[model samples]
Target: MASNRPAPEAPYEPSRHPETFGYGDFRADEGPWEEWNPTEDSLQQVRGRHRVAKQRGGGLARSSTVLGVGVIAAVGAGGMASANTGKPPVSIAMPDLPSVDSLLGNGSQETPAGSGTALSALGVSSDDSAQGADDAGEALRNRIMAQAERQQGQAENKATAAADQRILAAAAQAEKVAATQAADAKEKAAAEVKKQAEAERLAKLAKQYTLPTSSYTITSTFGQAGAMWSSGYHTGLDFAAPTGTLIKAIHSGTITEAGWAGSYGYRTILTLNDGTELWFCHQSSISVKTGQKVATGEIIGRVGATGNVTGPHLHLEVHPGGQATGIDPMTWLRGKGLNP
Candidate 1:
């Protein structure tokens, strides 16, 4: 078999074939397949994509920065306006962000800071605030002082009124005491004057009166129970005395009778100016005549036992005008300050 097939060409070398290497159907008019290169339009499209990506990223960063600065400016402007206008502060809710000053670190110090306005927009001036506070304090102090003064004045008035009341009460009590003392003194003075007048009257009456007889003992009173008298009772005061004892007239009077009359052995009757009659009965003898004017203490009779008497005694009797009934001589004599 080695004769004609020439050793089979060493098993055909396909690796050396044009198709195997991809150049068997190569064409000049068509583009080369092995070497593929991009056109200018395609290259431009890729470059555009890269540029758009980079620009969009930069825009996002710049937009975020602008938003932060705007929010800060709005907040600052609102606060400043509210403070300057004396309005209530406005509250704003915002996301945390860097400060506007920090973000604008490269800016100048004199640059308009908050919302591009001046610092005067913050609030009231310092001097004005201080003056307002001082004024309020002074007004309060004045009110307190005025109230205290009014209270003190009221208290003083009350004390003065109380003192006046006490004075009036004391004065009233003193007047009452003075009136009572004056009344007592007047009563005592009246009593003393009346006593002096009575004493003078008694002294004058003593000179005009006298006792009927001297040195005689009284044996019986005017009214006595006995069977020894004609009238069945003792009718006169009996003066027991020795015979010849002098019996005198009691006062100045006229002698109405002087004689022996029955049981009345020696009797005398004297009539006074007041129509009172004095009888001297049971006498030993008579010294005065009828119708004789006699002086006080003149001898009218002498004492003796007579007039149905058991012993020698002078019987004296007193009778009112026109009445034979005799009263007690002792009682009559005492009316003129005579004890007997």
Candidate 2:
């Protein structure tokens, strides 16, 4: 059996020592010699020394030294075999070894539960990791929903404001239209009231007066320009009719004059209570004496073509306050509520 003991060290030569030392010349054959070869018993004795050193706190250093020696011996043997057979050198593979801490049990206590280990340092379990992911997704979804709700609320507020604005605008327009309609209605009411008052006044006047002649056609209006009159313009109104046409009092009055005049033939003058005078000329015959009282529409004379007159007609003149000049008879008659 092969012995596992290491070779013995050679003796140091005096000549090789750097220190000045001398020894008597010696021969290798002259020294007392003993034939020494390795044996299993000798190897067992060296291994026992290694175990003893380990107990003295030198185990780690000794183990490194032993491993290095083994590697060198293995390489030397492989080299020698290759040189002798002239074959290609073989490749050697090394096995992984445990760290010093592991081999010595320096930090080899079982990891406490829930403490950081290889797996814990990397991450949590699949279930825990999935739960964390779900929580994050739910949080994001809640944030998105909250934001959407806020935006929706803002949109609704804006829409409500717009609707209110439109309502306000419509209300303002309605108010304006109502005001205009009220004003128009008020104006119409005022105009209607004024028209009704005028009609009532005219109706009262019609009962107080009457026309002077019956069945007579108007031949001349007051203010008519003519060559036949003494004045440049006609001062009276003329009524043309047959000789038998009757002339009557225009209102309740007393006869002031009767009989012939220079241009007004068979003239008659009536004076009203207000000192207004009505003159009827060109009469065929007189129906009342002077100073006689006559009622409205009572016959005073008959139509004739008498002095200074053209065919049968009545010339009527009105004098207010008995002035020398007369006003238009047609206007006075209209004021008394007679259209003719």
Query: In terms of TM-score, which candidate is strongest?
Result: 2
Q: Which ten residues in a row have the lowest lDDT in candidate 2?
A: 14-23
- Residue-level lDDT of model 2, residues 1-340, one tens digit each, is 7655555656533222221111234323222222234355643655334432223245436546765676677666654544344434445543223354543334542222221122221223445445555666677799999999999999999999999999999999999999999999999999999878877776787787788877889989989998988887888998999997988888888999999997888999999999999999999999999999998889999999888887899999999999999998988887776898
Off by over 4 Å in 1: 1-192, 222-236, 261-265
lDDT of 1 at 265: 76
For each predicted model, how many residue pairs clash, with residues at least 3 apart or on different chains? 0, 0
Q: Local distance difference test, per candidate?
A: 0.68, 0.72
Candidates in order, TM-scores: namely: 0.47, 0.54
Candidate 1 structure quality by residue, lDDT tens digits, 172-259: 9999998998898898888888877765765566567788888888989977988877788888888888888999988899999998
Model 2 lDDT, residue 41, Cα: 61
lDDT of 2: 0.72
TM-score, cand. 1 vs. native: 0.47
